[model samples]
Target: MKLLAGLTILMIVFVVFGIHTQQQILGLASDMQEMVPNISREINNENWDAARNDTARLLEQWNEIQDRWDLFIVHSEIEQVELYIARILSYLSSEDKAAALAELAALNTQLSHIYRKEMFNVQNIF
Candidate 1:
């Protein structure tokens, strides 16, 4: 009976401590919420110039992806994605980033299917 009582006390202590720690972490982000609306209003005023700088950084990384597969007759769908990402990287908006990334994922799947068929075709021809 004493062991049970001790265990209950320990659980209560741990729960209290856990709640305290969660509160501390939430407090860190709480201030950001207050700051967000003001920044968003400024951003709407073409104050997102820094975002354009970020767009340039993303473009640098995008450019490193060589279009070596551009002429891959086996996967023209994937090539289309490489070209689309190259063009979409020119935009600074986050929406374009999300859209391009989503499209890229889908095209990769299509390319995988195309690659499997291509391999079979080569084997059968020989």
Candidate 2:
């Protein structure tokens, strides 16, 4: 009876922790997603300076959450985001609007994929 009670309590804790992890992942991903569009718009308007600054800010935010993100997400996903940011920065420096926008789109897709993959749904459970 004591062992059963302990196992039940452990299971409850695990479930709660899983939910908390999901929330953190969703929040961090959403924060990054919100910034992507602004950068894209800046690029579209040919505002190189603004786009550069925003991209820098996005990189800063990513760095800040990176360790925390690693705790809940795959390292490859994090690496992909970092790669996209680097490419975007390079494209921005060269004022290559097309390349920068394409990178931003890829970054957005990667972020979306990260959050969706982490979501606690039936698809993930199987």
Candidate 3:
């Protein structure tokens, strides 16, 4: 029947969409991960200016990605990253290197959480 055919098409589309969404999320996380080393170096060297600039750039990239991600991901996960970025900025302003690094670690964890949750794993599906 036409109805059965239509339903099958819809299911295929859904699967494709889910796959694409997962890829996009993973890509965004990879981009962020790539910048981590430079940021870490800046932090370790106590180069506040460079660290601030790098973190700002990272935050900007995340903002751009988050706009598209909002359509696919839960807002809370997005908000957690946003909050972490803000906290990192604050710590940088105060020259709290320890706190800034801790916050960066938290941000990394959040990014990983987002990617893992969207993965097609048994834990997520069940």
TM-score of each: 0.34, 0.93, 0.94
The model with the greater lDDT, 1 or 3, is: 3
Give the alpha-carbon lDDT of every model.
0.45, 0.94, 0.89
Q: Ranking by TM-score, best first?
A: 3, 2, 1
**Model 1, residue 9: displacement in angstroms?**
2.7
Candidates ranked by lDDT, best first?
2, 3, 1
Which regions of candidate 1 deviate over 4 angstroms?
Answer: 50-126
- Cα lDDT of model 2 by residue, 33-108, tens digit: 9999899999999999999999999999999989888876779989999999999999999999999999999999
lDDT per residue (tens digit) for residues 86-117 in model 1? 54344325534445344434434443444443
**Pairs of residues at least 3 apart in sequence or in different chains that clash in candidate 3:** none
Identify the superior model by TM-score, candidate 2 or candidate 3: 3
